[model samples]
Target chain A: MVFVVVLLTTMLLCICIGSVNIPLKNTLTAMWNTLWGLELPAGVSKNIILNVRLPRVINVALVGAALSLCGAAMQGLLRNPLADGSTLGVSSGASLGAVISLAFGVSIPGLEYAGTMIMAMLFAFLSLLLILSLAYVLDRSMSTNSIILIGVIFSMFTSSAMNLIITFADDHARSIAFWTMGSLSGTNYTQSAILLGTLLICGGIILRYARELNAFAVGEDNARHIGVNVKLVKLVILITVSVMIGVCVSISGTISFVGLVMPHMTRMIVGPNHKRLLASSMFSGAIFLLLADLVARTLLSPIELSIGVVTSLVGAVAFIIIFYRTRKAR
Target chain B: MLKAENVTVRYGDHTIVDHLSFHLQEGQWLMLAGPNGAGKSTLIHAVSQGAPYTGSITLADKDIRRYKPAHLAQKIGVLAQKNNVGYSYTVEEVVGLGRYAHSRGFLAGKDDDGEARVENALALTGLTELRKSNVLTLSGGELQRTFLAQVFAQDPEILILDEPANHLDLVYQKHIFSLIHEWLKIPGRAVLSVVHDLSLAKKYGTHAVLMNNGKCVSQGNINDVLTPQNLQAVYDMDVYSWMREMLGQWE
Candidate 1:
């Protein structure tokens, strides 16, 4: 409840403090007018507040929530604190698919504009499958070390492949490079809607298994003894998290560390129960990213930094502090 | 009741539990005793459906594998020797997980029956004061008791324990063993435990199986199976003399 209020306030603040600063009253009036099909207020510009800032902030929040939620689920599923989309190479797989679509103009039959997103999502699932199968073949127990090692190797492989594609496609190289660095500048209502839909569906699936995830805290075999179908739950959660990471990456590019750091931070506050941890992590992630995006755009007045750069900077520091504090506490 | 016939567990040609058979009747507390590599734990794993075995293991006349995981869980509860808890869950929350099979649906609210069971389990294990405490902050004995309380809350017909009190102090071992003994007093309940301490096994077990090199050397009543001659064959030592000498030291 506290997180929800803070998140709402953060969103309003982010909307009001962009390149063209609008007063809080005007922002609220604009939002109210937009909500009830009324005309825009006299002082508010629809293009700046409604069209540009609203969708951008909403996309940031949705992507933030999706990434953090997936991270929490992955960490619980693998029983490894460091597990996330990047660790498992799913984000890289999505990036590869997006790059392929952009470089070669690949398009689905009817959904031409959604080519990158569809391809990215497909490849994300494929990457998770490939990595899991490889890990399984190497070690039947699928030990945490083996899976993480395989994921890191696969991530490196995909990154190299993405570099090769960028090199060959000269015309789209600049755009592809910018996309990989992550941005919310290009997000519109359509992309925001898509992100919102994916977050809801995937988040719902992850939340449904909170008990099973709690069962996993005692180890996989014990979870089985406690009646959790370990294999089925693992499959369901990994697939769902992969879908979420794919969608978030396709829309906002690879925003590193939000998935890895937000969950750990939230776990400290809410304890390790997924019932509360997941929801709290979503709100915290949203607020963190909204603030990060705010800094990225406004930190250097006219020269905008990539949102990814800002997040990596802030997330790395936050992660180190969290790590140090937890270790010290222990 | 539980029964195993010609059960063999293998890991890539190396047989861990070879052609082992045992029966656990209601009201009986069976103890599986062996040396370090004698496959006692593996046999427990096979019975609990954690490991695959070649032969049949049945609960209440039905093949164990034929039952769904949830249904089987409602019948057999296993307390493993070592539980790897990575996160910090409250003691009560961990105990409440034992009631998972009894509940329905993903978003189901807390059941009144489950809450009462959890409360009863906490009190039984003397963890009522620590119900809200983080499990990670517990001592070894307290942690063991927490898991024992979980299995108690499960209310399964057959309780399988692997070294239920491995590294605890004598007081904790006695408390836990007596709790299991008292639990077996209820009709239609049975227990199978793996124990390294021959003395504890002789004291608490109604039936015993002595194993060496994945093969059972003797199986019968506790006194019959734990004979000095059989102990000598498996342990390669004068079993009675060593225990007598240790007892003399205590005196």
Candidate 2:
């Protein structure tokens, strides 16, 4: 009940508090009219709320929630406090796909637009598969530190590849710039609907494994002994989290720190029960990103600063404060 | 009743624990004592089904291979030697995980007395005070006690502890073994522990299986199997007289 209240209240405030000076009353009526087929107003307010600001805010929340939830589940699976979704090179691989798509007119030969996005997501997903499988074959123990180092190496490789694309490609202008920086400006409602549905379905599948996740917290051997098909559960979570983060990064273009900070915050509050921790992290992450978007729009006025920069700065501060406080308490 | 016939644990080309056999009667506490590299942990891991072994293990006349992991967990509770907390879990939460095999999805409110059992486990292990403490902040002795609390909370028919007393001081060690002794008071319950201390094995265990070179050298009543001769032969140590003195003190 508290979570729902906080979410709705935050959404209302986020919609009302952008640079254009709209009251909460107006924002509510406009949103109700737009959503429930009521009446409307004939100004920039409706379009800003519907087309520009609203989508941007929601996209931030969605990415935040998805990334953080995936991160929490990943940490649980890997049994490491510091693990995150992209530490397995999933984000770098996705970044490479997105960069390549914009730098060159590469669309998997036959696909275009949305198909290209899917192709980028697929590339990122497949790269994670390859790296993890290699790690598996090299050492069945699957050391977390080595896995992270593998991710860093893969990121370095892809980063160099990205620079190579930038240097050699014909379109080195604004399009590549926007693709690299990331924005919610281009996507329509159809894309939003498709993504929202995908998030719900995939997110629900993970939530069902809540108890199994707790079993995993004890240890893999212990979890398996308690009737969880250890390999099967791990494979499901790994593939699902990789695909989800891949899709999100493909669209948003490498949003960082949401996964790391959100889970850590939730851990500080709720301990480490994955069921509660996943839910709480999503709630806190959504609010966090929405607030960041609010500051991005209002503080810089007409020339909007990128949400990523704002999020990284503010989130780093909040995390450092929380970490310091937690350490002091201990 | 539990029986193992021709149990052999091999890792790649190296056979860690050689072909071994033992039959444990109900209410018999079996202590496996050996040197550090004598594959005591390997043998216990194999029995707990935590590793693969080329042998047959039967429990209560049913082939252990036939039982799945969840069923096996209910039948046997294993407290591994290590208290390595991979995540920051509270003591209560850690102990609660032991009852996971007993908890079903959306369980009915029928098990009202269950809370008492879990509480009793905490009190027995002397972790009732640190129920909310983060496991990462706990000392090694406290963490081992927490693990024991979990094993008690699980309430399995057979308890399998692998080097459970290593980090504990003598007081905690005696406390833990006393609880294990008390736990096996029921007619059907038993304990199989991997122990390095011969004095503990003799004082608390009903049977002792002295292992060396990955095989059992002597197996029988604890006092008889833990003799100075067998102790020197297996562990190659001069602790036989020292252990006897410690046993007298414990008595």
Candidate 3:
């Protein structure tokens, strides 16, 4: 309940603090007007708040929630504190897919604008399939360590492949690099709707298994002993998380640390019960990313920093603190 | 209530539990007694369906594999030797997980009956006072008791345990065994445990299977299977003299 309020407040604050600073009062009025289909009050720039910042903030919030939820689920499913979407090569695969589309001018007919996103989502799932297959072959049990190892190796391989592609495609190199660093500069309502839809569907699926995830905390065999079909649960969770991460990466590029840090931070407060942890992580992630995005754009007036840079810079420091505190607590 | 017919569990080319057979009758406490590598744990794992095995292990005459994971859980509960809890879950929360098979739907909220069972389990394991405590902060005995509480909450007809008290003080061992003994007194309930302590087995087990190198050397009545000669044959040591010598230290 508090999270909802804080999230809304943060969204409104973010919308008001961009390059063209809008007053909080006017921002509230604009939001109210938009909500009831009323015309914007005088002195309010409808274009800036409604069109420009609203969707951008919404996208940032959705991406943050999606990434954090996946991180929490992955950590529980794999029973590894270090597990996240990136730990399984999904982010790198999305990056590789996006880079391919950009460099080779690959655009879907009648949906040219969505080609990169489509390809990104496609390759993200493909990478998960590849990693799981390899892990299965290596260890029929598909142990968590083997899956993580394969994912790390697959990430490196795809990153190298992406680099090679970038080196040859000089014209699209800058755009590819920028996209990889992530940005919410030109996001519109359509992408926000898509991201919201994905977050809802995937987040719902992940939330449905909170109890199974709790059962997993005691170990896979223990979970199995308690009636969880460990193999099926793993497959379902990984696929659902992959789709969520794929869509987020396709829309916003690979925003690091949100997936890794938010859950850890939330766990400290919510105490590792997925029933609360997963949902709390979503709100915490949304808040953190909204603030990070705010700092990214406004930290340097007229020269926006990449949102990914701000997140990594902030997330890394926060993560170190969390690690040290947890170690000390232990 | 539970029976194993020539169950064989293999890892790659190495067979761990080779053609082992055992049956557990309701109201009986069956102990798997063996040395470290005698396949006792493997057999328990095979019975719990945690490991792949060739032969049929049945619960109530149904092949174990044929039951759905959740359905099987309703019939059998397992308490492993060491439970690795990586996260900080409260004792009550951990015990509540035992109700998973009974709960229905995607968002399986704890029903009133589940809450009652969890409370009963906590009380049964003497962890009711520590219900809110984080399991990670628990002592070895307490941790073992926490898992024992979980299995108790599961309310299965058959309980498979791998070293229920492996590294606890004498008091914890007694507490755990006594709890199991009390639980087994209920009708239609049985327990299969892998025990390293022959004295505990002798005291608590109604039936015993003595194994070495994945093959059962002796079986049937606990006292008959644990004869000094059988112990010496499997352990290659004068077991009765060593036990008497250890008892002299107490005197």
Candidate 4:
């Protein structure tokens, strides 16, 4: 309840504070008009509200929630504080996938309806598969240190591939270059809905497995001793988390820290139960991202900053605070 | 009965547990007594199927290799000398994992059965009060008890403990043995634990297997196999003198 109230209210404020400066009441009126299929009053700027602000704001919030939730789940699933959407190379994989698609001008015909996000999703999943394979290969010695190493190595590999692709692409492809930095300018209601849909589905899948994840934190042997199929649980979590990160990375580029910080904060508060922690982190991350994105767009007014920059700044500060608090308690 | 016949284990090119054969009747408290490098831990791990080994281990007269992993988990549980929780998991979560070997999939949001088993295990190990505590915050003895709770939750027919008394106070140590003893009394259940403390094995063990240099030097009734002469032969120490010191401390 606290999370819901905070998130809904922050989203309302973020919607009103962006550069075009739509008044809260007028924005609501425009939204209501759009919802009810009613005609806008003559002279009101419907195009600004309809085409630009609403989709962007909603995407920011949804993408933020998705990424943070993925991060929280990854940390718990991998049992490492540093595990996040980007840690697993999902972001770099998505970027490589997108840049390659753009550089080759290779549009999968007809399914163009599915958008570049689909290709990004495929790349992210493939990268996740590689990471999971590394983890499985090291099954007997599934230490947190080993998983962290795998995540870092894979991220580096995918990022180098992404950099290689970027080097060969034309300046026209630079629009996509901002994606590697994580921008939210180009999303429409179509893309936002896809992100929101993926978020809802992945969130449900993760939440459903929350109990298994809780069991997993104890260690693989204990998990299996209790009757959990350790191999199966690890595989499912790896694949599901990959898809979760893929959705976030595809819609918005490599947004960082939300996943790492939000989940850690929630775990610090609620413990590692996964039942409430996943939901709590999702709410906190969404609100956090929406608020950060608002500052990114409106902080300099006419000149926009990357959404990733805002979150990383806030995320870094929050991570230090949480780290200190966790250390003190320990 | 649980039986190990010509069981051999090798790590890399080196043999750790030499061919060993034994049959433990139901409710038998079997103790493996040996020096530190004699592969007592390796033998336990091998019988528990945690390490690859040669020869055959049969439980309830069924070939061990034929059993499914989950089926074997329910039939046999092993407690290592130390357990490390990879994160700040709650005691309940740690204990709850013992149900995984008996459970099918993601626990259905804390089922009544799993919780009941966790509570029962915690209660048995005197850790029911610490269910919500963070495992990392626990003392070494308390952590050992928590892992004991996990093993208890597994409710295996045959239990294996590798230096189970490490870090535990004598009172809790005795309590741990008593809990296992009481559980074994239920019929068809047995325990095989390695012990450096000969007195513990002498007091609680029904059967004893003495090992040296990765081989069993003697095996049989506790009173027979734990004779001071046999212990001296296997451990190459003055067993009578050490036994007297243990008795002195206990008294």
Candidate 5:
């Protein structure tokens, strides 16, 4: 109840407190009028709320929820509390794909506007497969350290590849650099819809495996002993999470630490059961990003800091606090 | 009955268990005794169908590999020496995981029968008091007993345990052995255990396999396998003299 209330309130604030500063009553009234299919009043309020702010807020919400849930799943699947969406190089791989499509003007046949999205999703899956196969080849040990190390190496390679693409580009270098910093300014209803649909489908698949994830939290061997198809669970979770992160990054450009921070925060409140943790983190993440985006837009007033900058700043501080608290308590 | 016929297990190019064969009949408790690296745990892994091997393991006339994970888990349960769950769960939640094979949805089956078994296991393991405590806060012995309760709740037809008493106090260790002894008395249940305590093995093990360098040095009744001569041959020590000295010290 608290989470729902806080998330709704944060969404309201995010919609109301942008550069033009629409009143709360007008914001609510405009949303209601839009919902009931009535024509919005012809004013700056309608244009700002409907065209500018609502899509951005919805996009942030969807991306936040997807990333958080993916983080919870990865943590459970890998049996590592520190594992998150970015831990597997999904973000970097997606960024690389996005950079390639942007720099080379690549376009797929039916996905003109979503060419970058398609590429990002493809590369995200490819990176996961690469990590798994690399680990399998290197002594068949999917130990936590090896997975993390492999993910780091993939991130380095992708980032360097992205850099190479940027260097060769004469006209698109600035645009590619800005996109890599992650902003929600370009979102439209179409992009938001894609993110929302992906979150629903992938979230359903992930929730179905909650029990298996709980068993996996004990250890892979324990998960297998308790009748979970460890291999299947691992594959399903990795694919689902990669898809989620890919879609999120494609839409929002690699917003960092919502996955890592939101789940840890929710776990402190809801305990470690994945079922509850998953839901709580979804709500917490949505609220967290909504607030961060609000600050990103209005804190400097028209300068418009990148959403990734704000999230990383907040996420790093939060992670340090959590790490310190846990250490001190222990 | 669970039977392994010429089961050969290998890691890379090195063989761990070489052409080993054993029969574990219902209602029998067999002890696997060996030095630190004698491949006892690897053999357990092979029999539980958790690892790849050359030969066959059969339970109740069905090939072990043919059983799905859930079905196989219902037929056999294993308790390892240590368990590491990345997140902290309540003791009851951890114990209830044993019913994962029988469960259909989240948080185990929660049927009356499953709940009753979990309760019984917790009581037997003396973990009823800690049922609500986070497993992360548990002492080593407490964690060990908690997993024992988990295996008990699994209610498998066969139990395979690797050093189940590793971190227990003397009283709990004796209690755990007695509980295993009692569980083995059931008509269609059996136990395969790896234990380092020779006195306890001699007292409770109905049959035994003595291993050295992955080969069985002796196999048969407990007395024959645990004879001082066989013990010395396998361990390269004066077993009778060491036992006498230890017994004197205990007195």
Candidate 6:
């Protein structure tokens, strides 16, 4: 109940507080009028709320939920508390794809308008496949530790490749840097709808596996002994979370900390039960991102910070505190 | 009955468990005794129907492999030697997971009967007081008993345990063995355990298999197979005096 209230309250506040500080009453009135196709006293207010801020808020919320769900699932599947959506190198691979598209002017045949996003998603899947194949070759089985180690190596490779792209594009360096920093600008209602659709579909499937995930947390052999098909669950979770992370990165350009931070916070609050953790994380994630974006919009007033900057600042502090507590307790 | 014939477990070019055969009747307590690297644990893993192997195992006249994993779980419960959890699940939650095969949904939200089974298992294992405590804080003996409770909650026809008493103190070891013995009073229930203590094995084991270097050194009634000569041959040590000393302690 608290999560819902916080989410709805923050969502409304985000819609009202961008560059122009419209009062909450006017914000809701403008939204209702614009949505219902009724006349409004301030046409500009309607335009700003409907066109400029609504999609951004909705997009950030969707990305936040998707990333957090992905993080929780990844951590459960891998049996690592610190694992997140990027454990498979999705962010670095997507960044490399985005840089390639931006620097080389690459365009897909029918997706020229969405060439960068398409490329990002494509490379994210490709990097995941590479890591799986590498793990198979090295261990003759897809062990979780092997995949994590190979993903780290792939992340390093992609990061260097991104640097190479930046160095070559002297005039486009600033554009590439801004893209890597992450943003929620230029989203439309259609894009937000697509993200929402993905979140509902993927999140529902992940929730259905909550029992198997709980079994896995006890250890894979133990889960299998209790009747879970360990290999199949691992494969399904890996692919589903990778796809969710891929789509989220393509849309939001690597919002760094929502995935890693939200799940941990939700876990601390709800205990380690994945059934409760998955849902609470989604709600908390939406609230976190919406609030982060609101701060990004209002903190400097007209000089908007990247949403990623605000999230990382908060996430880094949380990470340090958690680390200290866990270490000291141990 | 649980039966295995010509079972062989191999890893790469090495044969961990050579062609082995055995049959366990219901209500029997079978003990597996062997020196290190004798493939006792490997044999247990292979017969549980999960590990890769070249073998044929049957439970109640049906091929073990043919049963769906969930259905197989209902018939056979395995208690592994080591239990390592990634998350700090409460003791109750860990024990409750044994009902996964019988559970209708993902969360193992047990019905009344299932909840009763969990409660009974917790009571049997003396873990009711620690039900809410995190498993990570449990002592070694407590953790062992917790896993035992999980296996008990499974309510399988057969229980395969590896080193069931390894971390337990003497009193709890006797307590757990007595519980297993009492559990065997139910019809169509059996236990297969790997034990290291000769005195305990002689007391609780009705049937026994002694192995060395992946080959069965002796197999028959527990008293017959655990003879001093067989123990000496397998362990490469003088066991006649040791056996007498152990038996004297029991007396």
Best model per TM-score: 3
| Candidate 1 residue-wise lDDT, B1-251, digit = tens | 89999999999889999999999999999999978899999999888878878999988899998988888889999999997687998999999999988884745555668889999999988999999999889988888898999999998999999999876789888888999999999999999999999999999999999999999999989999999999999999999999999999978
lDDT of 6 by residue, B114-157 (tens): 89999999999999999999999999999999999999998888
The list of candidate 4 runs beyond 4 A from truth reads: A42-44, A108-118, A134-146, A170-176, B63-71, B97-117, B245-251
- Per-candidate DockQ vs. reference: 0.80, 0.55, 0.88, 0.56, 0.81, 0.78
Model 6 score (lDDT): 0.86
Going through the candidates in order, what fraction of the true interface contacts does each contain? 0.81, 0.54, 0.93, 0.61, 0.78, 0.80
Q: List RMSD in Å for every model shown.
A: 1.9, 3.2, 1.5, 3.1, 1.9, 2.5
What local distance difference test score does each model get?
0.89, 0.78, 0.90, 0.79, 0.86, 0.86
lDDT of each residue in A17-101, candidate 1, tens digit only: 9888999999888889889999985768777888899999999999998889888888887777887768878899999999999
Worst 10 residues of 1 chain A by lDDT: A139-148
lDDT of 4 at B188: 81
Instruction: Please list all clashing residue pairs in model 3, or write none if there are none.
Output: none
Model 2 chain B: worst 10 consecutive residues (lDDT sum): B104-113
lDDT of 3 at A62: 95
The lowest-lDDT stretch of 10 consecutive residues in candidate 4 chain A is A221-230
Better of 2 and 5 by lDDT: 5
**Which of candidates 2 and 4 is the stronger one according to DockQ?**
4
Q: Which CAPRI level is candidate 3?
A: high
Model 2: per-residue Cα lDDT over A60-130, one tens digit each: 77877888888888778777656778777887788788777776666655434664477568778877888
Rank by DockQ, highest first.
3, 5, 1, 6, 4, 2
lDDT of 3 by residue, B1-251 (tens): 88898989889899888898988999989999988899999898888877789988888888888999988999999999988798999989889889889895646564668888999999878899999999889988888888888898989999888998876788878888998899899999999999888889999999999999999999999999999999999999999899999999999
* TM per candidate, chain B: 0.97, 0.92, 0.96, 0.93, 0.96, 0.94
* Candidate 2 RMSD to the real structure: 3.2
In candidate 4 the C-alpha lDDT for residue B9 amounts to 88
In terms of lDDT, the poorest run of 10 residues in model 6 chain A is: A104-113
How does model 2 fare in lDDT?
0.78
